[model samples]
Target: MNEKLKKKSAKMTKKDGYKNIPSVDELMSMKQSGILIEKFGRKLVLYAARELQSIMRSNANTNTKDISSSINSLEEIVNKYVLKDKTIINGTGVIIHTNLGRVPLSSESIKSINSVNSSYTDLEFNINTGKRGERHKLLNAYLNILTGSEASYAVNNNASAIMLAIKDIVGKGEILISRGELVEIGGGFRIPEVIQASGAKLIEVGTTNKTYIRDYENAITKKTKAILKVHSSNFSLKGFTSMPTKKEISLLAKKHNIISIEDLGSGLLIDTKKMNLPNEPTIQDSIKSGIDIVTFSGDKLLGGPQAGIIIGREKLIHKISKNPMARAQRLDKSALSALTTTLKHYIEDEHLIKIPVWQMINMREKEIKKRVDAIIEEIPNNVRRVKGTSKIGGGTMPEAELPTWLLSIKIPNINTEELLKNLRDLPKPIIGRINDNNALIDIRTIPVEFDKYIIQSLNKLNKKYK
Candidate 1:
């Protein structure tokens, strides 16, 4: 140590009523050829110094010789770490929060997934027929029962479903779509982009805000191969806007000898009208609309695994099944198992409540209020009910902000934004809103296990602020 630093260290220790302070080397083991020191010189020294500093800070003592041994022990335990894509709790109220994983599998579906994944009887092998059989057949009857469609098939996601159909059917031909329907989804997936990638020519019809049936009819040419209508699930055009319905588009496609495809972004298995959500066409309703092919997501409103399912006329599905890309987009045994189980829950309709996404979406105002009341019972007088908004996020209902009952806290220590950030940093993060300097927790999204943690967190925040 330098003369000045040495003197300062000694003086500080003396003032603190300490008898002595050991030299850095004295605290460490005797150097044996300094091999470890040569390998990790600064790291070893800094670690030992910090350990000594910790001892000094707490007025504790340690034989400094154990410093190198601790580092060696830590180094021995290190191993290669790999990142695996897996499940995470969605604290955000968007029932199908895309980024946090679109849906939570039902207990039954999870069991099916485990069973199929652990052992394999037939992903491609046909056990019954003892020949090469279609993998989609496993999920076909289940989907047909739910959607009233003649046939069904599934790919990895909705985008693949669209691509598989168009790439096989509309090859080397123009496909017509409305400009207003060419909306962008989360993570930059767009309609025009997908169409172009499928090797199909883009024929845009109608205006951005208003597209009529006549516009589609005008766009039709000998080169037109298909007609695509997309639901603007992320946005809505209100007042002075008109668009053609499925029937009109179907007629236009029929007259032109072209297939009509309706891509329902948030495809719901059961009606959520009782939950006060805007009514969108279900998979069954789409099939009944005279549409040639219907594509939708399994995760969004159906609350299942991530999949792109196509249900429609058996002829079109057969064509899609034969495509070269079908191999790439096909679902695995796990997906089939989970999705089949998820679709089966829709058979009785009443079992919808058993699904977490459905339950959260259908949570009534009275129920949310009850949860809020329970939360208030545990929290201090500092937190109270504040009128606020909740969202059906994940791009399903962009125009919808669920009227949520918020329990808010007014704290002085941390700013509202920082307080929310801190809550989000918890072990199982708590996500809430900040408005008018109050942190609002919409009881709608909080899981049952998190209730006690939320109470403890609120109390800690109150104590910190006080």
Candidate 2:
């Protein structure tokens, strides 16, 4: 053949190689494909198959081995595109871990959620009057008993709660806030930004360390509408730091004939000092101090669904609830159901025993050590019991650390990072931390029911690594 013709023929042969690559129809006929289709829907499986075919064609190789390997890659592609939010074993010992779905609902709360989610509910229907009812009044009685507030409202989250309060009460007016009390909550949501978003002017007063009540008084003018006090929930300022008390701020706002609002970033119903942790002010404390309005999170320290709860005087709460944003930020039926159940736990004086957040917080060190000892006994590897600390995470308590026991695993010839990855790759991913080149599993955040999954994962790792 001529040189040009030879080159053309070679290119043709290479192009023909792709003819052996499986089509979407052919791939869908495979038994393995049927399994994947059953696990993931047909549409996803088909998309994965088409993607695999494209990859195989791009490589310009369609040998039998390559085709078989590409077929096996179908599941990998589908898994990669699948939803990643699933049940995970949190061995990270940080109770209320934000990334792991902070504040796991109690059994009662879960039951309430499932009950409300699976069927029609009286969410806004007034069965007593045979007419439509208001959902906002559902939690009033529960919150009134818990926080001693004249009225209460719940929105989607704490940020929304504060925003609604500011916009409704202080629109186009100056809101005084101490420089030290200006805090940024989780996800970079700052107090000043919230104020600005509400169309109100932010008057930052005093230094970052010290802000007397006089500073607030000095900042107030004819345009001043409210005084905002934000709790530094995720951080603490130590020596030389001084801010006015909640009572003082409330008194100052009263003297100026303006609103007083306090954002207790993580709202607490129970006392933390009783659990041997640092004192965190409760929602009731804010109300008792004569604050006209209080905002706090339901998911963080409250051990409820993600909600922004506002409690204050009847008139102030009524005004805030009348804002159009309140409807847009209101909680759904499922969240309200779960939150009501959670509140019931407190009302019945069973919060520490029934609510998962409090249960995890109040977990005794000896009980945690016992679980660690049992886990170490089950895993036949280079695992040892070690002392560690559990944190009250989710931007609640920055300085509180509870004593805990950890299972430190150091397998031969395996690095700590690789070990953690392997554990994560298991069916039920086990999330842990590294300590001094060793993999540490702190079971403080893990419930006892999930211990078997951890044991199984560790045993499987031991066998594979050994």
Best by lDDT: 2
- lDDT tens digits, residue span 1-466, model 2: 9999999987886688777777778888888888888988999999999898888777764445344555568888998889976888888888888888886899998999999888888888898998998786658999999999999999999999999999999999999998997888778888888899999999999999999988888888999999998989899999998889999989888887999999998989877676778889999899999999999999998999999999999998988888888889989888999999999999999998999888888999999999999988898778899999999999988999999999999888788999999989877888999878889999988989998888888888888889
Candidate 1 wrongly placed segments (more than 4 Å): 1-91, 125-133, 463-466
Candidate 1, clashing residue pairs? 94-393
The CA root-mean-square deviation of candidate 1, after full C-alpha superposition on the true structure, stands at: 9.7
Over 4 Å off in model 2, which ranges? 1-39, 46-74, 83-85
TM-score against truth, every candidate: 0.79, 0.89
How do the residues 266-315 of candidate 1 rate in per-residue lDDT, one tens digit apiece?
A: 77667667767777667777788889898988878787888899889999
- Residue 236, model 1: lDDT of 74
Q: Local distance difference test, per candidate?
A: 0.76, 0.89
